[model samples]
Target chain A: MIDFAKDVRLWFAPSRLKDEGDTPDYRFSLANERTFLAWIRTALALVGGGFAVDQFLPDLRWGVRVGMAFALLAVGAACALRAVNHWVRCERAMRRHEDLPLSRFPVVLSLGVGLVAVAMVVVVLLGWTSGR
Target chain B: MSGPGTDRDAGLQPERTRLAWRRTTLASSVVAVLALRQALRGSGSSTEVAGAAVIVLIWLVFLWVAHRRIRALATGRPPGLAPRSALAVVGCTVALAVFAMAVIL
Candidate 1:
């Protein structure tokens, strides 16, 4: 039978995993960690922005309010998930002595933010035209 | 793997990384405080208050973990790339987002 206990330990403790390839410089690994943290903070900022928009902004149509809030939260959730995935990919690549994987996160994130900005503009215009 | 001598010679890499961690933690704390303020200003419902409290608690925990990591780096200890606490912080942040969404909607 497979050792579930060992599998659990490995799953929880990435540090315990054996090194696969030549060790890269500690600087690179530290940099990777810092990048991951930056992404997490970005995600937090998006989430906070979502909450603020929903709470503080004058009430738009129900649909628009909900849509914008969902969009922001969705992007934030996606960013958080990507942060973890990028961290894992970078760690694996470093372990294997492979070139770091290319990340499309910045592009996707900017696109999402741009869409949200456009939506907000539309929302503001709608609110201005409609008396409420 | 960095030896102690090499770590000392590394010329502020660890220090910069530690600072990055601190900055991230500070950002999270700011977000948490904003959330708390929003919750209080709004309906002041129990769940919103609870959610804000949880966020503040999680941010504190993150700061503590970042502190530990900085100390480890200062001592030239290789404390691994990702700590479980970092994962916990991510999880909590995501949860906070979801809770905020629910409250808003």
Candidate 2:
């Protein structure tokens, strides 16, 4: 049986191992790091939004409110996980003098946020009709 | 290892990277505090409180690691570039998500 815990630990191992590849231009590495940080900030914003919705928003149908909050929280968690993966992949690509990997996170993030926004709008409309 | 000649752009690159790291740490700390406050005020449950504490602790550790990396960068040391702390952040975020769901449900 595979030890999932050990696999996870190994997967997140420090990027200093071996240091085999040539160091690319410092600017490229710094840019990649900055991109990683940007993604982390985005994730943090999503998590904060989730908290705000859950804590502060008035009840617009408990199920819908909870669903919206859950979606934001899940997407935020996903963004955080993806940020580290993208950072490591970009660093490795730079070190190896290879093309950087393409990222689909933007698409995922936009779609998730767009869906949540639509849901909130619908809830607001329903509230207006119901006079609540 | 010091090379014979100093590169003109070396200082700026590390400084920029350090700033990015600091910005990320600040953002994560803000989220952690928000989570803590929401947990304390929304539910007041022991599990939620514990989860928020763990999240804050992880963010603190991340800040410490980032500070050390910034110092190393300033001194011309190669950054370790580890994602271990970043993963910890993600793990804590997942825990926070669970807490949020619990409160919502």
Candidate 3:
């Protein structure tokens, strides 16, 4: 059984970087990857969480099912894009000797929160209807 | 494993990863359990529930592997390179989309 994580670790080893410094660009980049993985996990959590909603709301219509799934899918897609965005920003920060980007949190958070809001409305309507 | 304190700190990374996977796996497992119930209950009469169970179980296995791998990396044990799981995940997702269509339609 091969271990891809280890391989990834080796592949991104800071020694491979052209410059190693106290600024810790490499460290930041690696942290970026770990954080991105965390987001992916969150996306999966949303998907799983959405399913649990389904179990209780079995009589739910397609809109609810699909709506919740759409929210989860959006979260997943956003995470993937954020992963690339983070890495690129980190790399650029290293080149410019600046801090890694800080703006992504607000953007992603707003997007995630917005989707949850819409999903909640759909769930409420569907769940309420199913109840009666 | 190539920075100040990072050498001594390498152990923390795996712990964090394990924690993330633990949380994710637990959530996914719950989904599986719930999906199984839905399947038995014939909720939506959708094939997605069965698919959910399979996805959850497979993810559980992946989580276990992730946990073990973190430990291996932390202790400086050799990690034989494994193939990327992306292709398989993508395939599972495509299957999921099709199943969702069947379930929802």
Candidate 4:
């Protein structure tokens, strides 16, 4: 928990992340950078999905629409935060020659997306039935 | 066992990274356009207009940064991304997501 607090504080101090240890191989850093960019893109897609659901699903019930859109938006925000934190941790570890950090985020993200997809299927079926 | 010291894949890494940046820039552009569309199509209240403007600014900043990074990678030995620049990119991404959520709400 202490580490988490320090990271939150570090949000305002970006330069400090690179201040420690020697710079690792440029390729490794570039790979890390690309990974960070990928995560950011994923976050953008999720946020886009949120608004798309909100705007495209005019027939969706109000409560369900907002709930779904909010869920997507929340996940997007979380992903954005995770991307930066992971990038910082990876960069620091590389500079210090420590083992790369591990995370369960990919598994969790997949599960969350799966759950949303299932809910979407149910919502679609309900819409079909209600119209008939 | 190829390692970091190996030069067998020289240039490829940076090339891929540059491509990734380009793709991300395109993705962000799409999101920005969508957000703008939402803002205009909605009630067009002053707050929504301001929010849209902020999103546009963030998008432009991100594009500039990504474009700069892409150009840097074209060199034989591109420097590592600055920590501050990494933070700036992440900030723009998060801000974009927040604005998108706001538009939805």
Candidate 1 lDDT at B105 equals 64
Sort by DockQ, best first.
Answer: 4, 1, 2, 3
Pairs in clash, predicted candidate 3: A2-B81, A2-B82, A3-B81, A3-B82
Candidate 4 docking DockQ:
0.62
Per-model TM against the reference: 0.82, 0.79, 0.56, 0.88
Estimate, for each residue in B8-93, the C-alpha lDDT of model 4 and write its tens digit. 45459988998999999898888788777777886878887888789889989998999889998877668887666777787887
Please give, for residues A1-132, the per-residue lDDT of candidate 2 as tens digits. Answer: 253343345446664523638877667767777787788788778887888887777555566667777888889878877787777777777777788888777997898789888877877877732234
TM-score of decoy 4: 0.88
* Top-scoring candidate (DockQ): 4
CA lDDT of each candidate? 0.73, 0.71, 0.49, 0.83
Q: Which candidate is the best by TM-score?
A: 4
Residue ranges of candidate 2 with Cα displaced over 4 Å: A1-10, A15-20, A128-132, B1-11, B42-52, B77-80
Give the DockQ-based CAPRI class for model 2.
medium
Better of 1 and 3 by TM-score: 1
Model 3, position B69, has a per-residue lDDT of 48
| Tens digit of per-residue lDDT, candidate 1, span A64-89 | 76677778877887788678666766
lDDT of 3 by residue, B6-36 (tens): 4444445545544654664565455445445
Q: Which pairs clash in the backbone of model 1?
A: none
Question: What is the C-alpha lDDT profile of model 1 across B1-70, one tens digit per residue?
Answer: 6664754634677787888878877877777776677667657788767877776777677778777887
A5-113 in candidate 4: lDDT tens per residue? 7776666676676677988988899899999989989988998888787777877787888888889888988998898888888888898899999999999999999
Please state the CAPRI-style docking class of candidate 3.
incorrect
